[model samples]
Target: MTTAPVQKSSYDRYPTVPLPAGESVITGAAAWHRVRDLAYERAEDRPPLIVVDTYPGVDLPELTRQLAEAWPTAVIIDVEQEAAKPIEEIDARIADNLTDDRVFGVMSHLRLNAFYDQERLAALAERLADRTAATVLIGWGAALTATRPDALVLVDLARWEIQQRQRAGAPNWRSANGAEDNLRKYKRGFFVEWRVADRHKRDLFAKIDFLLDGNAIGHSSGVVRGPGMITGDAFRGALAAAVNAPLRVVPFFDPGVWGGHWMQDKLGLDTETPNYAWCFDCVPEENSLLLSDGDHAVEIPALDLVLTQPRGLLGAKTYARFGAEFPIRFDFLDTVGGGNLSLQVHPLTDYITDTFGMHYTQDESYYLLDADEDAVVYLGLKSGIDPDAMIADLRAAQQADHPFDTEKYVNAFPARKHDHFSIPAGTVHCSGANSMVLEISATPFIFTFKLWDWGRVGLDGVPRPVHVDHGAANIQWDRDTEWVTEHLLQGPEELSRDGDVIEERTGLHELEFIEVRRHWFENHADHDTDGTVNVLNLVEGDEVEVISPTGAFAPLRIHYAETFIIPAAVGPYRIRRTENSQSTRFATVKAYVRGTTRTDQEGPALAAGNKGVRS
Candidate 1:
């Protein structure tokens, strides 16, 4: 007899798994209790399993002491106070959680370490499964399976707790970014939406709803998560490994097909499709759908979290989990099926501060998601054409191509799949025609500098304004134009890498909130975290799965060529491969890396690989 297909993506089997819905936040203390309690409830008796982390933080012991007063006693094992944060600690946490070969178990407050692995949570699940064989497992935060894998009980406490606490002491925009005058407009909170049904609180469907814009799913979200908080976990075990331990992933996002509208022919440019679905705009429930907003996304860095260190390469995170002063947002885009993007420019940190009296950090880059072998992008100006020449022509109502001095202009050549040129602040650039790009940038939400818009109109069907004058002044004239064109003019190096299935151009420029790189995976790499969860992104991959510490993995097929974040705060994880067939390249951005220079020093050169690469 033929059997019916099994239903997936739900937790009906594990009725007790408390998954929150919508905007409500959940904290770590509540998360720990949920897991520990579930572990006990699922116990089958042999010397009940006792789970723990590498170095439970200050609050964990207090929580445990509180838990013990009301629950059963268990063994305590400390990995070491100073263990390397993400890598070493995660492995150890898993080993200590399992019961003896034959014993039933109740793991309490297990914390795992986290890292920047693209597939953080997947690794967490696998490790957890390996160590313990409990019938049901309890988990909290990001990256755990919906169902209990062993004696583990998990609840996604990250989103809820994060947004819940993000509103502490926000910036006095008046003084923070120097945008004193523009400070009049402030978002109460990025993801706070109206018309939300409160009863839909624990529904994953509900959460995803927040991230979609009816038709498309991207619209740039923003918020400041603040200095002390971090995303609860990356690898599943990592959360259990570093409970109360500090960690952070500057908030960023993954985009998907959603709402967007582009008016074709209006700009006098060719059109592939009149209406593009640049989905990463203003949607909601971005965490579940795994969608991200574009360069416009506002992510806050956590203060206590471990980040790449030049020591202070980025500003502290101030949004969810530890909620901060500004509004936080999450969104993404739809490249192939995405909507039209402008060929424009952004002001440098200085200009945004000087001219506009604001801080509009340089969140720029040249992203080529797809190429037809003949695609060319106008990056910079012709070698000798005066800046005023272009400006004067535009002001005199000259056609764009005329005064552009095509000879002085350098063509960004051989556009290939996944080729990215870093364009730091004060650079003149665009996303080029055809390719859809995932633009992960900084947190200030104002667009001051602009260039010719090719004469297109906004979604409302009116002509969009062009800022040629501001553009001229904003483009960094001192940058070596040749160096940028040579490396980014496009060729084989921009197409493939050793053993890489994905080809990409990265290391363009650096910023306080984000780090962009390009890579291709020949075979999926195993990235498990100790406990904190990570946002696993697939800029071009088709499928991936994150294995938890216990070996239970969550599989995803990213056919849309979008990015996804993986959160595995309780354990380790691994990303399974989708293809070994050939090359696929994509950019990897580390959000909120920390600002290299402060108000005190001259801004150091953008990290590397970015800035003024385009004309």
Candidate 2:
């Protein structure tokens, strides 16, 4: 099939979401009155519940007082005060309650979900109802047992904002040692604890009446209608409008031992932290969507969109393949000016499910973005390398506290910008220093088994733990240097050329559920999701605009290194090139689920060239 030219229509302009500044929406005492007015039309029998759920250490006493003044007959009830046990007692209980080997990540302190007793809160809500006056329950999980509040306001702070607040030495209920322990656990892995805590809060989305922007809390804040208050019919209509429009998720960053300055310096991220290691560009599990209604912005977990509109976001085929789960994930791994990452491998599909209570495995690939002239990526094993010998060496190094020559066993390939390396489950891989890699993979993250860490200690001055036995069991012994070069080591191949645009395909291994392609164009390119969700990354060029064919969406402008997703509901959409002084040719990486039927676009699909599976 030949390519077509870019179509011009009335909606051929850049898409913009008008989000008013936080100060304009909510600032001081005047702003408090405006926030109180959100529940003005409601009856007195069911009082407005403005649950100011702030991050730890963020005291909302002043806001609470203002809320009381706005409703003279309303009584403020702090959930923290209603706790059945003291903070110290809860801490001890949590320490003694551990019986499993579950991991802890960023939300470490909440692993036990030990803050308050749910039964107590439910009973408290009942007793408070006996009073003749209106009741305003304010605190985290306050609305969990609330009796149909007129309003439920959620004050959420970004991850970075929480980090900054903690670094500023704000007073938290936890002790200094407890805080330090949580931080250490976060660096180890944030998914285990975070997911558990978040699963309970999923229903909170349906309960939220208003969302308060806490990005600049104490200075400025913004409040908008929440997704929970919208009816199903209304949400469906809004979802349709959003699908045709370009959507961007609120990306989050975390630091690691092998973090680099590439994202910190190039992306102009927060340098106050150690360094930027991983950027969750489009991972719905940990990312949130910033939706604006022309006046205010509300933040909702990206999973909410997937859960509510799976077919609309993920195409029918993709939704069937992975129901209510965003299968693809785009993230950045920056090791520039830092040390090499740990030599690791993920478990196979069946292994992961049997071991960890997860249904899917984390099959991933590395797309080199920025690299030093001599940068190398360690992958697979050297020819004639013995698996038993390597396992013994790893164990010996761990016991002796000594570093071994890892280069002697593993093969290293020259890493250049735009190089694609397929790393299916059981393949040993690690991005070396001085390279920034974009990791496109399955959404089941945080299951890496680190075999070696170069004998280095973590930022906490303690040696990071390694799982040599786990890695040894999962490593594919047959994947040697020759296998790596013949299968994983390859570049994007030109598939079809049409005018100034050319479609180049890469990472087409059978082991991977998703396929990647790069579109090189000077002006614009046409693409169809084809019953699947398409994730786009502007790897090259300054900025580009994504426009819908039927003028259903507002034109969205995406800059270099930024990632965005086009829902399957969009169907056929055009990616129009925008003017940029930096470069002329715009190169974007498009990823989507591999169709059941395959065909030759311009040539044959690039094959992994591997024969054995689970051998």
Per-model TM-score on C-alpha atoms:
0.45, 0.80
175-285, model 1: which lDDT tens digit per residue? 132222111212211211100111122222212111111111011223322111111222212222222211223222322122222211111112333444343321112
Per-residue lDDT value at 280 in model 2: 84
- 1-615 in candidate 2: lDDT tens per residue? 333332332211112233332312333444445445665557444545545443343345644665666566667788767843565775565552232333322223343245667778767877766645556777655655564666666655444444445545433433343345444434322433234334544455565555554444443222323211222233334445565556877777778898998887777665666777888888876676555545544454566577667888887777888777899999999999988999988888877776654678888888888899878888899999878888888888886556767898999888888777778899988999999999888887777888998877777577777888778889998989898777776545667899999987776466777788888888899988776789988888877888888887778878778888988878778987765435788888888887622332336643532211110
TM-score of model 1 relative to the true fold? 0.45
The C-alpha RMSD of each candidate to the native structure, in angstroms, is 19.2, 7.6
User: Which candidate number has the best TM-score?
Assistant: 2
Cα miss at 609, model 1 (Å)?
6.4
Worst-scoring 10-residue span by lDDT in model 1: 10-19
How many Å off is the CA of 7 in candidate 2?
Answer: 36
Model 1, CA-based lDDT: 0.34
The TM-score between candidate 2 and the true structure equals 0.80
